[model samples]
Target: MRSEKEMMDLVLSLAEQDERIRIVTLEGSRANINIPKKNDLEFMEEVLIDDNMVFDIDNLKGFLNDTSSFGFIAKENNKIIGFAYCYTLLRPDGKTMFYLHSIGMLPNYQDKGYGSKLLSFIKEYSKEIGCSEMFLITDKGNPRACHVYEKLGGKNDYKDEIVYVYDYEKGDK
Candidate 1:
């Protein structure tokens, strides 16, 4: 298992690479003014890195300049344990969708309900903002997250698409 710091570094690096991911915020104790209010940054603690690293706050800000990004944090007792990053996009059908880029909790927090709660919040918020669909892609090796998503009513149309989609369109089926 990767250490907490290593896992967090991977998460941050992925977010930086994905242009769709616009916001990066930590949840636990401190308030990060960077993440927008649309996505609740309330739970997990923020990512803390050693000062020796070259990357700094200014670099992060420069990367996450788009205003359309949003994220969530899962925390317990003022300590961050997990986080999620997402972004919105307009589909070819002229409807909007929320794409869950990444969601993960620390090893100690796994099997707990934190992941479910965070996803639930994101689902509800997506509905509130008129998203016609919300979806995510998780590795097939990670059955735990897949189970959670299935339990929350996401469809298993992952055969060829490799995506779990939650369609909210009305009366089109």
Candidate 2:
């Protein structure tokens, strides 16, 4: 588990890498309210890093910068424990679809409903914003993630589906 300080640092570092992500906000406290609204900076917290919180930061700026981007955060005792990053895809019919790119919580916070809360928060928010559907892709090996997703009424359409990741830098594909 990463210390609260480490987690915040990781998030901040990712935000700073690209000018597109100007303001990063943490939301979803116990009251189910959103704090530090988009472009709101006063509510951001600073912490000193002493441990590692791992996640892929690649293309995060593009995701965060998208006009359709929106997500929820989980905090406890005034510290960030989890975050869900996502964006919406629009169709000619005008019904947008929400794609949950990623979501995770600290080790100590897992299996404690914090993840569920974040998922539930975003799921409802997506609907309220006119999203026609919400979906995400994950490795089947991650049973924990799959379980939580299913517990929240998520369906698996392609159980044997395989995912391929292509990392191209600068202009390579």
| Winning candidate number (TM-score) | 2
Tens digits of per-residue lDDT for model 2, 1-173: 76645544555565555332322223444335433332222223311121222333334344455677765555665656766667789889988999998777767788888888778877877898788999999887899899999999999988677887775853558
Looking at candidate 2, the ten consecutive residues that score lowest on lDDT are 42-51
lDDT of 1 by residue, 30-51 (tens): 3332322222222212333322
TM-score of 1: 0.61
Instruction: Estimate the overall C-alpha local distance difference test score of candidate 2.
Output: 0.63
Estimated TM-score for each candidate: 0.61, 0.65
Local error of candidate 2 at 143, Å?
A: 0.3
Candidate that would win on lDDT:
2
List of clashing residue pairs for candidate 1: 43-74, 43-75, 44-73, 44-74, 44-75, 45-80
List where candidate 2 sits over 4 angstroms from the true fold.
Answer: 1-31, 37-65, 170-172
Error of 2 at 166 (Å): 2.2
Each model's lDDT: 0.62, 0.63
